[model samples]
Target: MAETSETSAAAGDAGAEGTEDTGIDPAIFSQLLPFDPFDPAFHADPYAVYRKIREQGPVTRTPLGLVVVPGHAGVSAVLRDNRFGWGDGATVAEHFSEAPDGTTVRPFIFMDPPDHTRIRGLVGQAFSARRVDALRARAGELVTELIDKAVAAADGGPVDLIDAVAHPLPAILLGELIGVPPEKHERFRALSTDIAHGLDPSLFLTPEEVTRRDSARAELYEYFGRLAEERRAAPAGDLISELVTAEDTDGGLTGHELVVTLTLLLSAGFALTVNLIGNGMYALLQHPGQLAWLREHPEDVPAAVEEMLRYDPPGQMISRVALADAEVEGVPVAAGEQVMLMIGAASRDPEVYEDPDALVLSRPAGRNLGFGLGVHFCVGAPIARLAAQVAVAKLAALDLELETATPPRAPYIITRGLRELPVRLTAAD
Candidate 1:
């Protein structure tokens, strides 16, 4: 979830829109603004800034009139509401494009009703919970294999868990699930990283990075287009085959739609699961007592995973445009307005969670905006959760210690993940 060009550009146009739209003085707008997205300190600890935003009341306005919803209730409301979406593509047009063949190439997650409803409905049939749950046993097996290989390669030295497990686990599973050949998993992972970084708001990307991101997306589209054709000629048991068959249904996904959808599923799913595993492991290491509790109560690992998502979600911000004049938890929003739903901030809102800042492994599972809610909810959530649950559960059994108290954070803010989580591991004496 990168900011659409309109919202990102709004930051530049804020001076003019500030007084004209919201009657807020441009000079004092900086004081009213949320944490600086570019600051490394903010990346390390955005919760502090989230707390400050919460103090400003549930909904705050950015200088350019983009609405900021930091409260859990308000954020959830907008997500579940019908009136807010990527309407007319004015807000997120950067992410959506016209394919060279002149077909619309927007991810369904960014589309408004009717279009979104149709594609998601078809996608859901293939991405069912039953289908996803079938992978748990295999996921566990893969995690065990990955961890053993990591520890053996470490040879008692520090290993970067992210490099060893978090990144590879999802890439491998998604490859298997999406019909990508095992030989190409590494290539998929590399492309996923480029696209994931590109997914950050352009404000945060260097020109070189932007070029890489665009190039990666183009390559992936071409790769999937070829794969879709193969699956069409001879359908397989993977998700791609199921999606290909879906094209036969009336008003079903076109060839271009299939490619973009798979791209979204693979890239977004990879980034989300990787961060969930990386962030969950880091949180558990930071809170050893909770880690120990989870080890003793292994059945509670599912609940613990939920807590991890709430504590530090992978997708930090979700962008939406008000399709029509709407009210979010009583605040009136004009039509065509852009809203920034701070998932990180909403998840930790004190009004929703007790000791919002603390990580409690046993904290009862409740709704968190991590995977979002309503129709636009993550279609690949079940698979992502399964991958992370297996990865985290497998790693928790080991004798692990963080090599550094503060590991470096990923440069991109959208996917709040570590570049690498270096750690020491050994067999229990």
Candidate 2:
């Protein structure tokens, strides 16, 4: 609390700004109870702040004049209610200085209805149950191949799972899903990294980030557009082929839209899957009983994956704008106001689950907004879930232990993940 007081003095108390003060300092408050999606502190440990908001009330009006909804019901209500939407450019332009055209290039996930509905239906078609199920075989193969490499690299030393297992497994799988040839997988990572970094609502970007974003978008357009054209002509078996050749009758996506959609799939799938693998593995190792149970019953991999998502989700924050004067669970919301849903916090809401903070592998099935809900739900969710289930199941099958050295986490505010998790693989007796 003393530390919080010092932070309040340094950053100015919220009380002075007419907002009811959280005992935590505004600087600390910004991190924990972040009104700003890019708040540096909240990126550090948002779970603490999520708890604070849930405890205070379902709806929190931040010092930034932003509405933060933390409870599962409130967050779910906001996402499902058509009253809230992705809002116009003016809503986001206040923070990001990207060009207006650049904003149009925002991923389909950031698009509201009509456009969201159209693109999602088209993109969603590519990830049919059969397609995703077939992709699972490839995911399993990649997991095995990556695990072998991790063992070889370990050669009696600790292995960084991010390098050998977590990252490569997903990268290769995503490349295959998008029809990228195996040889180009190495370069794919750098491109995906650059594109994924801009997936946030930020006040500003460093000159470097701006450069990377522009470069990534251009490269994606050129690269995927080439692949898309080839697929349209050749009609190969992969997702890109399906997308290019998909006939919607209501006029299919334009060439530029196809390129942009492919770009979103490439970057979003890899980034989220990587985080899911890293975060889930870390969570399981942190809770040995749960880890042991998963190892003993591999058939439970699906439920375990679900629990992992709820325990430590990759997508932390999702927001929407009130399309018009509206109310969330009866709380009056003026037209055009922005409401941020804390995904990670909502999962831990006591009202939603028993022992909300604990990791329980056998926890009863529930709707987790980790992949989000409603119209904007993750289109690649099936593929992501399958990939993670295989990765975690395989990893748990080994009698390994997390390395004593603290692993480095993906320090970015956008995705919560570990960059390099070193673990010691042990032979089963």
Candidate 3:
């Protein structure tokens, strides 16, 4: 998504207070500071604030002149609109360079059409529907293996589901997909988490986090680079190898495009999937009726997966910059303005779905911006859906009682999901 001048200015003002003379509402400014994108508290529970913004209007201008699109229709409109441009590396550098260390991180997913088109097209072939469906058997096998280990570890005792299943399953899957060695999984997993956290702007990091992020980036680039080189020499079955040889009308991705594309796929590929599984499990356990229903009719697994995504999406929101001056949901937004599309809030908008707050597995499948919309829709969506279907099916089949220690939510806002989900299982006699 593109970042607008309004958003950059608002974010630049960070913790400052606004006055009537400044043409900014004090309440709006207060909400903006406390709800910084990186704040853990915001991640824990943002629905209330989302509600507030939604009721205020579909589009509301902030003290910093940035517009916030909160309602279901409003958020959906932004996602579906083509006029908004995805910002480039320079934009990211401008927004994040204010940090103490002043290092810039660029992932190709953040670029505009032609560039995004070229990069995404190269990697897109690997995540084709057929390829993802073909992996279902493997995905199910992996889930079963992880579940077996979890059941054994439980031994009539409690198990931290996140550590045993939630984290490792997707990590292993992504690793295998990218051809990372089994032995290097643990190291790479740790690095991925740290780097993901570093991307959060609200998490005030010490110099240590800065150093770790830089190091992680270097290591990841080097690792993927070597793998890409090997793929060039002799292609393999993995995604990297496929990208190394992929071609589009324009041409194949360059070395830099390949690196950036791989980086984004690696970061997004596992983190959100793990969260989807973990969060979906937690939700089902909390609502046992839904759990039992899913278990009783395995045929409903696909619908259940969609409901899970709509109910508590792994990605809370996405940003876009206005390519031209446009009025969104009646609010006038100038060109180069930044708009935040609240996907989570939009899914829960009562107008879009009946009982937006309630989780209904059988609800008619309406459009969901959860995977995004328009040309920038998530490329990994098919694979993610297949993986989730396999995961939820296996989970529903198990004879288990979910014991929630605490409501699960990540400490970061952009990618939201369960940190840890603890549960108990009763072995089949």
Candidate 4:
């Protein structure tokens, strides 16, 4: 989370690279009902808007034909059903498929079965359970060090918890996970931040912001390409080296695919995980009952993290295109129509969770759409979970107070997060 002028000015919306959209008219969604990225009020509390959307029905359509699914069951059905995807790039939003340079390569997240299965499988090979699990101890150590620095830096005043722990913790670990040298950690964080703001549809951003995003993407592409080449020549014990050699029935990835995949993993993983920690902490501080409960039941950190995700998710919307005629919760969807799944709305659907809006750490562990579902479930979920749990548990051990009850949230519609969470921290005696 190296902040740029545009990113900071915009209140720091975190965008996932590759998911950035160039075409498909963000203007349509901006003006339409049930979703408005430009509205400051909506950004502050989108769940309130979501409640209105859910009241409409399982599915609602704009005059422009964008299908909006706000109910939990409908959103889940669309995600798991094979009939919905970015088929043949026709239904895929240009931002998700096309680059600023006019090239088109749908990231695996947007691809259909064969291609999606192939690339994701190769990626999964590199992202082994053993590799991810091994990072747990290291993550805890990093959180401890970061919290210590935040406590020391406060000097009896409010500190930006995001800068102290949420932002850097994930960036450092992601660098370690991807084999980035310690020297380049700051650069890595900065580029990812620029790309994160650019992750919103082009319509929501200013011209300058879009330019910075594209520029950052190009720079990252060059960097990853060089790194991949280096790894190919002499493989290291890092995930980048592992990815260089990852193969399946289709054989190894091309140099370009390797670069794209690496960039995707780095950018997407970094943004979501950063927001999870930031948003989760903000939620806890808002609910003192839950915060006290977490302190009393330290073992429940993981469960509390899940509840945080559901209560105020990092990734709020997931887009899908119908490949063929299909139905979501009995709503007919023609081929080529785009369906926007409001994850924030579905997670809070009263039909699914008891007191869906409450921050209930003790709530039963159940299926959630926080990281998504089916083939596209977040690949970095295990690591993200580990990072958030460690950060939350450590932060909760302190006497914490929010400097501002209602923090400024990023205005980006797709992802939901606070710009900064200033908290007064003191060690528990």
The models' CA-based lDDT, in order, is: 0.81, 0.73, 0.69, 0.79
In candidate 2, stretches whose alpha carbon ends up further than 4 angstroms from where it belongs are 1-45, 92-106, 201-203, 427-429
lDDT of 4 at 139: 91
Total clashing pairs for each candidate: 0, 2, 4, 4
lDDT score for candidate 3 against the true structure: 0.69
How close is every model to the real structure, measured as TM-score? 0.91, 0.87, 0.86, 0.90
350-382 in candidate 4: lDDT tens per residue? 998898878899999878899999898899998
TM-score of 1: 0.91
- TM-score, prediction 3: 0.86
The C-alpha stretches of model 4 lying farther than 4 A from their native spots are 1-30, 90-103
The residue ranges of model 3 lying beyond 4 angstroms of the native Cα positions read 1-45, 87-90, 94-106
How would you encode candidate 1's per-residue C-alpha lDDT over 1-429 as one tens digit per residue? 445664343232232432344443444534434655445577779899989988988888886687889899998899889998887785666677467687768888788888888899889888878778888999999888887888899887898999999999998888888889989998988998887666644543456657888888889889999999999899988999999887425666888898899888876678788999999999999999999999899898888999999999988888788888988878899998878888999999988899999999999878878998988888888888899888888889989999999997764545678888999987553
lDDT of 2 at 138: 74
Per-residue lDDT tens digits for candidate 2, residues 323-355, read: 889887678999977777778899898888999
Better of 1 and 4 by TM-score: 1
- In terms of TM-score, which candidate is stronger, 2 or 4? 4
TM-score of candidate 2 versus the correct structure, residues matched by position:
0.87
Q: How many backbone clashes does candidate 1 have?
A: 0
2 or 3, greater by TM-score? 2
Residue 226 deviation, candidate 4, in Å? 1.4
